[model samples]
Target: MYPADLVKPMREELSVVGFKELHTSTEVDQAIKQKGTTLVVVNSVCGCAAANARPGARMSLDNEKTPDHLVTVFAGVDKDATDTARNHMVPFPPSSPSMALFKDGELVHMLERHHIEGRPADMIAQNLKQAYEQYC
Candidate 1:
């Protein structure tokens, strides 16, 4: 597990933008199962997460249509929560710094790590925005 001090700022990057942090399996399950569209960000301490994923997620919210709930689970930090979130993302292998969108508790869209790494933040945001337009 990562020391809390090491991840506080990283967690704040999303928290400051209104993404609720899910630190336990139950919290993750509850957040995803809530009514309306929910966006789940499996956050990480990797370069792509800092350079692309988090920023892209924040940028995506600028859209007129957005998910009803925004939540995140920190990989390498919140083990149970991250694992639970990954279980919901089945069919796709687990990847850090990933994003998933769910409508009425069903997975609707997903952006895996490969989709974020080496990509510009705006391009990732545009991809998510497109998903939001359709699923949100």
Candidate 2:
């Protein structure tokens, strides 16, 4: 795991953008169950995540009908939480720097790592924005 000090900045960046950190299995389950609309960001300790996915998710909130709940699970640092989150996201394969949009506890949309990697932030954001309007 990366040092807390190193991850603090990333955590804060997402938190300030209204993304809640799901640090426990209970938290992950609670965040996704019986919800209106939720966005699950599977965060990664990678340059592409820093430059693309996280920023993309942040910017996506500009659209109308944005998720009522926004949560995250860190891939390596928060292994248990991430794994638990992945379990909740059954049928969807594991992918860091990915996102899942759920409506009323059903997975509605997904953006995987390959989709997020090397993309321009705005482009990624735009894709998320579209999904937000359609599903959130």
Candidate 3:
């Protein structure tokens, strides 16, 4: 696991935007299962996460259409939580530094790591805003 000290600011990048940190499988399950729109961020300690994912996620919330809940689970630091979050994203492969939007307990939009790594933050935010407009 990455040191908590090292990832504190990274975690804060999302938490500062109102994302609750889900540290256990149960927490992930309960958080995502709620009614209304929920945004789950499978956060990670990677370059692209710092460069794009977190920034994009933060920017995306600026949109008028936003999820009712925002939460996150660290990929390596919270293994069970990450796995539980992935289970909600069935048919989609598990990815670090990903984003999943669930509405009424069903997965609606997913932004995998491949989509985040090479993209600019504004582009990623645009993608998320589009999803939000359609679903949230």
Candidate 4:
């Protein structure tokens, strides 16, 4: 493991939520570019991440219809990879604890930080399940 001092909590938040780590820019691109629907979760260490986004994502994943691949880019921790991943999400500003659902290399659904902060986890999960139904 890399130093826990930097990236552990960020990783655990997503891991516990069932998201796979995509540590390299190449891995991020590969997951985004590969076949089938993919959910790119921009995981973060913010309170919103812990309180709403991560738990919500975990619940959504329990639904029968989920994305083919669940991947995460940890903001601040994976700076360049996160920046590169954000590039693929054009027109949206960078937001920690955001969620982006992609289909066949194109962005389809995006949940920004403002959409996540202070919301109920179930609400967030509902939105995610809707995105999964539509795109995944």
The prediction achieving the highest lDDT against the true structure is 1
Counting only residues 3 or more apart in sequence or on different chains, how many pairs clash (N, Cα, C under 3 Å) in candidate 2?
0
**Residue-level error in angstroms, candidate 3, position 81:** 0.4
User: lDDT tens digits, residues 62-107, model 1?
Assistant: 9999999999999999999999999999989999999999999999
When summed lDDT is taken over every stretch of 10 residues in candidate 4, the lowest stretch is 1-10
| TM-scores for every predicted model | 0.99, 0.94, 0.98, 0.92
Stretches of model 3 off by over 4 angstroms after superposition: none
- For all candidates in order, the CA lDDT equals 0.97, 0.87, 0.94, 0.86
lDDT of 4: 0.86
Which residue pairs clash within candidate 3?
A: none
Stretches of candidate 1 exceeding 4 Å from the true structure: none
Instruction: Give candidate 3's root-mean-square deviation (CA, Å).
Output: 0.6
lDDT of 4 at 119: 96
Model 2 pairs whose backbones collide: none
Tens-place lDDT per residue, model 2, 19-98, is 99989988888888856999999988898899999899988888866899999988888888999888877787898989
lDDT of 4 at 17: 62
Candidate 1, residue 30: Cα displacement in angstroms equals 0.8
lDDT of 4 by residue, 1-136 (tens): 2355766876886777667887789889999997888888888877889889888888888787999988998887777779888988889998988999889989999999999998999999999999888877
